[model samples]
Target: MRRLFRLLTIYAVFARYRLDELLPDHAASGIVKFFIRLHPAAWTASTQVHPWGRLRLALEQLGPVFIKFGQLLSTRHDLLPEEAIGDLANLQDNVPPFGEQAAFDIIEAELKGTTEALFGHLERTPLASASVAQVHAGSLKDGREIVVKVIRPGIETLVQRDLALLLTGARWLQKIVPETKRFHPVQVVTDYRHILLGELDLGQEAANGAQFRRNFADSPVLYVPEVHWNLSTNKVLTMERVYGVPVSDTQSMLAAGVSLEHLSELGVEIFFTQVFRDNFFHADMHPGNVMVSLKDPQNPQYLSLDCAIVGSLSKQERFLLARQLMALLDKDYEQIAILMVEAGWVPQSTRIHEFQNALRTVLEPVLERPLNEIEFGPILIRLFQTARRFEMQALPQFMLLEKTLIHVEGLGRQLYPELDIWEIGRPLLEQWLRDQIGPGAIMQTIKRNGPALIEQIPHIPKLAWDALQEMRKLSENQQKLLQQVEQGHLKQLRRDRIITLLGLIGLGAGLSWGFNPHWSLSWSEIPLGAWVISALGASLILTRLRSNPDD
Candidate 1:
């Protein structure tokens, strides 16, 4: 009954927002028409509401789960319209907290102790709250200030229940809707399910945070909070509490004399460093999870939180992604098309000319804008959408990267509206690409594996001899197989010849019986067996000629 009510409320919100306008024009009649009519504002273009606006409003009304999904969807500019993406970007994840008592209960249960034993002082009120969890300010028994994050009571059950509902809707949409299969709604839900479930495990998030801290340990641009493992569990987390201005608090940052330009550019640098240098990145980089330090406003470093979602790519994916980005920056659609095929993103059989043309068609307009005016994230997303038309399969790893890129760029633009992202990112990417293939990399590889290489050097001669022996045996087997095939061919040829000779003799006899004057046999006197022989003989002769045209 709860699920049914929630589902009905979602439909009501959809109708209230006139989201059904997103349906195809053909759907305005028939069984779909009744549902379409449920929308209060349908066909009211004078209302000054765009489809994207309605979508954003509807998601916001649907609750935190839907809002988060919208936030994820907003990042994929390649998959949605500009207006829609823009509207969804405004979706916020803030939701009302369940209850302070419930949070305390969860922490007590997870820690196997009363709050008084674990902390010298535990705040009855939460410091922050979101859909999945809430955080409380507390002081350890040892006098260190920390924050205790407790998973919302019964959140697992709620998330699973809502996810099942989402999957049902996705299945229904795919069945009844047209042109939506490309979005792969069901697959989106499945992927979200995995990520959400992973986020539910505080242990995994602690590991991610710890790894991120190590990756940026020596760096001056970003700060990752330290996780208190001794006090952490699967459903509870205790971490060092750092005070800084929220990255979204630009006015406060400006008041503190923070250099917005440097901060914006540093965001780009940090992103590239994490991806190319460390190969591990915090995927959920929304403004809510980021903070700007006040210690050095001139050389501002970012503080990141909520490490539940992180991402990395395979070596091949990193290479291809870098090359593709460079190609796009250069406006070399042809190179991008070639790379797509080479990277196996598109089928090898995809026509290069057509693919190139398609890429240029999608990218030309985006590239025509000024370097500072163009959005790097959206263009990259648009490339994915265009590639889809050429039957390019979705790369799940890239999805995380793409989402992170959108967050980084969006936050950067907020800090400095005129920021040239390409200018900031291009040099870093180029340098990384060069370092990957340069002589220095080779020297480093050899130096790292010097011992293994030296140990294998002694076996080189024996390995070469074994390879030669194997090749020799393979060659001999190949020759024997070819000989057998030729012998079989000759035997088949001889058999065919015999069959043709017998067929010809039968044909000749049939002709003599029917037409030859010496045989004195008319057509009426001819035996049916003779006709059958003649037909069979003709078929055999044709078959032999077709098989060996040289004959």
Candidate 2:
């Protein structure tokens, strides 16, 4: 009942935001019309008017979950309407801290020691705080500086409960509402749960940081702080302290002697290198999380922090993304559209001609401009909007990729206003394309799999026997579920059967009265007929509601 109440509260809030107005227009009118008739209110047109502001406001009202969702959604530049994407991007992670003492208590308890023992000194003041966690500064025993990160207390329970509630609601929508199948609400929730789960583990983040550090150890372009593994826990993270001018502070960067144009071009090269060469890029390198190293001003290096979120593309996804980017650089719109469906990024049923036409309409206007002026932002939004028409399910990983890319692009332009991203992106992507589609790739794949394939050949018989056993078990489980559902149906039918029979009898009597109305038509016919009709309608609706969809 509490869960149900919570759900209704969510709906009530959504109603106020005018999200309900976004529901498809007059869809399934006959039976659906009566069901939704109680709620005559419509989705707000305000979402379109100053969409960005409206989006931020809606996310605020929805709380942390929505803020996080907005953050993720902002990354899918290729999958959202321009206004919607812009609005989501504008959402600030700014939120009030819980309390200084609450943070200290968590840190001390997590380390299982006093502040003095863990560090020479610890600062109570937080450098930054967000909806999920807070960060503080401290000095180690040897006077080496570090930062202490502590998860807000009681956060896990609240997050878990909210996630559970979300899952339950998603399941209900998928099962009870046939119309939602296309939208795949349950799958969306599943992806959401996995993302939340990833965010919950600071250990994973610490490892991500360490891996990033390892990958860039020999590079001069970037520096990642080492993870103090001993000091780090699942809820608490300790790492080497880093300092530099914030990436967003352009004036400071310029004053520090960094050549803006060179710095920006370098940033572009670093982004491509990370995605293609390293295959591991910091997916959350927002301006807030990045800084510019001022030691070598003219040849600047990027100071990166906050490795809590990272993204990696599958070999196939990376290849397709590379191919699509290359195609855009080559002015091959049809190739880009073809890769969309070929990569399973869009539904196969989408017509190539229609998809290509839609993309061309979006891209041509932008492409007519010089490469130096073209921004990836508008291009990404158009791509997503067009793909969505073809029923693409935006992957969570893709969102992170786009977010990082946007951050890189914005940072680059600030350093060098005239930098042509296409010039930087094209050659790198083309080389990657050659590497991926080359004969060497085929030989490598075969060589890597050859040994495994040979070993598996010897176990084929045993593997087949094991598979048969699993199939038998699965078949039995299905039978048992079927039986259980049948019993439940029988129980329900027993209860409704009496009501249905009484309803029929009442209906017959009402019909008889109407016929006898030939002798004397009276007001009794109206009441009798109404009751009979109500009862029959109620029975039918209940039966439809009660029956299991699978059954």
Candidate 3:
């Protein structure tokens, strides 16, 4: 019954905003328009505001989930109209704060103590109120300034209810419009559900913050405030209070003598460093969570906040991504297409030349533009959209990274219109690639694993002997199977071939061990016993192959 009510509320809001008009002309839209026109609210709905403005207002009225949806939509410049994207960009997490009493109740309950006992002084009002939580300024017992972030009470319930409604709506839309399947609305909502729920856990956010602080402990590029673990809980987080001009507050930052050019470059540097060097990065880098430090205006630094959502890629993914970026810079569309298929980002059967042509058609014009005029965010979006034509699947792991890149690019451009991320990022990426595959990296890998290899050296002879014994048994078995095959038992021929294949694999393993680079001993210096094993294994494999060429 409650869900039905929520559905009705959503419908009323949709009608009130006349959102049906926003839909493209289609059979589905015609049906929706007919129903909306029949509704009494639609007749009385205000027409004074632009449709985009009405849409934004309706989302805000629907609460946090919808407001966040609007924010996400704002990044998709290709999908949304310019005016709609502009309006949605204005959707901020500026929800009104809950009462002061409720805030104190939550903090006390989470910390297991009264506000007065836990702090020297706690504010009666919130410093900032966002969709998921609100922050209140306070001082610790040691007179250190801090901010207590308290998750709004009952928000989890509200989020879950809204998510369920969203999922239903998504499924309904997909059913009504089969073409929407490519967009994967259901999976998108499911991912958003996990992200929203994760934001509800302050403990996770605290851990993320601690790790980020440690990553940049000595760096001037960024600062992550200290997390007060003792005073934090899943419901409440306490951290050192930081003061800086918001990155979006251009006038204030300029007044403080902050170099916008340096600041914008630093933003790009911070992103590359976090993604490539540390592998862990704060995924939520919107202006609200980022501020510019004033300690040194000439050498500006970023103060990062709200580390609840961070992103990291697997080692293989990082390597492939670096190669892909390098290829993009070099205009090697063929390599980009090859890497996408190799990474399983696209189907294995994808026609490489065709894919390359598609990429070139989409990206050549963008790459032709001046470095300062190119927007990496939209380019990535276009690349993914092009890949979708060849049946590229959804990449849930990259959603946060994509969102962060868009935020970073948007913020960098806002700070300095001429910010050339390509200039700032190319060298860092090149250096990182060299470090990953150069001789130093090889030495480091060997040094890290040398001890274990040495420890296993003594057991190699025993393992090799065991393998030889197994080979002998298999050889004997193959002889019998081959004899049976000669007697017209064709089934035994397949078994003989299987035994021969196994023996070949065992011999290959022994040969690889003998030639392993970590072994300091030369071929002449190798123990006689090891040489015997290698020779015997090689001779057996050769004899079998010579005797049965088909096998």
Candidate maximizing TM-score: 1
lDDT of 2: 0.77
Error of 2 at 119 (Å): 0.6
| Candidate 3 lDDT for residue 435 | 93
Query: On residues 125-226, what C-alpha lDDT tens digit does candidate 3 reach at each position?
Result: 899898899999999999999999999988988899999988998999899999877677888788777777788999999999999999999888999999
Q: What is the Cα-based TM-score of model 2? A: 0.74
Choose 1 or 2, whichever is better by TM-score.
1
**What is the TM-score of candidate 1?**
0.85
Which of candidates 1 and 3 is the stronger one according to lDDT? 3
Worst 10 residues of 1 by lDDT: 38-47
lDDT at position 444, candidate 2: 85
Per-residue lDDT of candidate 1, residues 171-226 (tens digit): 88788775677677888888877788888899999999999999989678998888
Which residue pairs of candidate 1 clash? none
Instruction: Give residue 141's lDDT in candidate 2 (0 to 100).
Output: 97
